[model samples]
Target: MQTQTKTQFDFIIIGAGSAGATLAARLSENPEFSVCLIEAGVKDTSPFIHIPFGLAFLARLTHLGWSHNTAPQQELNNRRLFWPRGKVLGGSSSLNAMCYIRGVAQDYQRWSDAGAKGWDWQSVLPYFIKSEKQQHGASEYHGDAGYLCVDDLRHTNPLSQSFVNAAEHVDLAQVKDFNGAEHHGLGFYQVTQINGQRCSSAKAYLSNAMARSNLTILTQAHVEKIIVEQGRATGVQLHINKKTLLLKANKEVLLCAGAINSPQLLMLSGLGPKEHLADQSIATIVDLPAVGQNLQDHLDVLVQYRCKSNVSYGLSLAAIPTYVKAAYTYTFKHKGMLSSNIAEAGGFDKTEFAGEECDIQYHFLPAILQDHGRSNALGHGYGLHVCALYPQSRGEIRLLSKDPQGELHIEPRYLSHPDDQKVAIAAVRKAREILAAEDFKPYQAREVLPGAEVQTDAQILAFIRANSQSIYHPVGTCKMGLAEDPTTVVDENLKVKGMSGLRVVDASVMPSLIGGNTNAATIMIAERAADLIKQEHSSA
Candidate 1:
């Protein structure tokens, strides 16, 4: 990779995370285009990022993520929620739980029905298969040789097995593969891992691509704004340390800065709501009213239980020996407890209020998840993370100032919609039932979060309002839809509305949040986008 700063490139992809890294790799493969991938954080050198189990530890480490929080949510008792977005090379893919979910078929169908033409399930499935290198080899739904590696977990806690059994006991059919036919049942999730180590987008897509002469990767380079000249996004202005530099894109400037930062970058470039930009004294290049609207996220509510034995991955004297053994095994062979993605297993189920598809998703953790695993596990415990898939509430990403370095506020009005609130309540009730099933008889324990005393639906709702958090799947800020929609930022091809030589190629362009983890969908978007860009330019 050429690190010497170049003023121009065929394509400038901002934010070297999941989509950006993948897009850079695929775009540069043509050799007809030179791509520069810009990242705000340093490389993904942290051992915690590569090791699967280290995701729990990586959560508390703020340096790896954007430490931005949402504005006080009135619906959640006026509480501010912290959002951890990957600022490093692979972006959130490096920090996520590694669940390789492509969401259900209906998710893509909804996207197409909502004006994102050609994004239906039938159209997008090939892209998902095209990007996946599944450990189980090539099948109708999986690929053998692709950038992203998907594999089964090498280690799973005994308690996680009980959770799966409990799901079966409760009549939620056993799912052999969550991504195989449908995500309607319960089962262990496949992760984006290769031989126990995380196969992040940076590792999968950018590792080899960075060595290409046509690709340039700029680390620790914060993009301040996109430079739009006469309504065309020409390039970007970035800052490295105290030095300010301008890089131009000969063909297109791609904004892959995830959800929070992508909209902020757009607004900073004087392309957001004119009135809001005027408030910050920013000159409006385009009066795009919906630039930062339509923000959506999965508000997660966790049900915790104290384990009577040391089976859970918690800090204890008894676990010392286990950890020691795990350390030894992981040090040399990369197998054992250390290889376990803390969220070892998860499944999907629906409540009575749900439609034909599942309404709630469950991530079963063998250890206690405190504040997104920020807190060290004090005692032996287990938890179930339940989230409503399709939230009806909407939010926005607003800028605090016109300065490129100003704060970007996230206002996720979680549980504001009555339908979402209904789903949340049902999710908690269903979670309790699953926990109390006969399958968990061996590890029978007491509820830690919403205790037995808090059994009523009203009480459960109150507890959820106080304790629920973001599942880290924020998307749809710069919604992708037809230009006729007032809240649309990018159109079917992901090009910015009324703007030329620019596109938003990240999670922000999602019209709605998918049914499961957003990482796989984001990577698939990049793959499909690379083809779109290639086809468009090749014909141009």
Candidate 2:
């Protein structure tokens, strides 16, 4: 018997997460392209990965995520926040709240104006439609035959609905569809789900393509670095099964390792800032000054309150009967409390400091989340997460050490800009108003965060600085723009500038953060990238 190991591929995609998985499935459709998707984590076999409510346990299960911690953020009380990116097949889609949102048209307009040619709203909207299997049926703005499922959440807590109603009471319009015409309004979030199960990118894109002979999926393979020979990326050097192997890509090596890892991989491959590489004794191959620059993320703060009604998703001895019934419902029907995505209801609204339309976003959770749900707050309480959508602060991801698998110096520089603080205060105030509206007065509970005594703006800002977290939408590390632009790492087509045969097809290449959950947009990018690659290789 002879052992067989495939070392050559027409296209090699690193990180079998959202973009990688979508690219793998789409690129391999022709059967002429030999696509290899490499994942650093194990298979997405954990039951928690599929169940919608299982996300509460996912944060504690460190094995499913890349345990990336930021350097002490000076603006955030010098606290080093825990930033979790998925290591599993679907990437963060497997771990996220599954809120499916395609940012307003203005978001892509920013991409176009920023010199990302051919990436305007009108051009990218089709890809969003092409990638989704919308439950509302096909229309000018949505598609029904696509692989990715976008449907109304199977279960929503009554308190979640109350939040939306409260928003209406506060004069925010109620929008039936955030992805429809108007982007401003409050409503129950549509989720990436199917039949009460989480429809992660892996499930939507990878599952059907798993048996494709042209598509090869390699899990538990950590890519040490990209192989760039004479300024052109050719393959990947990786460690799998305790053995090192150099897999060759005859056409292109797509870097989809996401914002943090993608930049880290580039720096390790001697393709980052010349000065930074020199400090690590890395011979600069491209001297791309912006490889890890231009980092952006949404800084979120929770405005929580104790629930007088025992409807919140809190664990307690008093709530035993409700949970027992919930378990029975989930086991028998697969729809109930178990089907809920904690951040069930949310809204997109413009603050007074608004730029292009909206500047603030909200997530109303039926339960009070403490420390990203790692700590069990066993009581009846609900929390609303308020996040500044557009941040003025830009940070960078740096190599902490020369080791390929070492820790990264992740610094988001949250609240470094004075403008972000203003948005935070406004966002919290807006959330406070909605929670205090007539609809919520019935279930009125005492404020738990920034109590009634903390009334002034200065106090609110202080509370925000001391207790804020990443909404997990980190982007723009490997920014995309015109090649002449000093800040751009990738060009409009996502090709790494100054380096041939390499492209970044992940959130890292985003020029700026879109104003919503990033999972859908990331998938849309992959959809478009797959089409581009297909066009480029049509004759091959």
Give per-model CA RMSD: 1.4, 1.5
lDDT to native, each model: 0.90, 0.90
Write candidate 2's Cα lDDT for 144-178 as tens digits.
98999998988888888888888667788988898
lDDT of 2: 0.90
Reference-based lDDT, residue 416, model 1: 82
lDDT of 1 at 376: 70
* Model 1 steric clash total: 0
Worst 10 residues of 2 by lDDT: 1-10
* Worst-scoring 10-residue span by lDDT in model 1: 1-10
Model 1 local distance difference test score: 0.90
Tens digits of lDDT, candidate 1, 102-175? 89899999999999998999999999999999999999888978999999999999999888888666888878
- What are the TM-scores, per candidate, against the unseen true structure? 0.98, 0.98
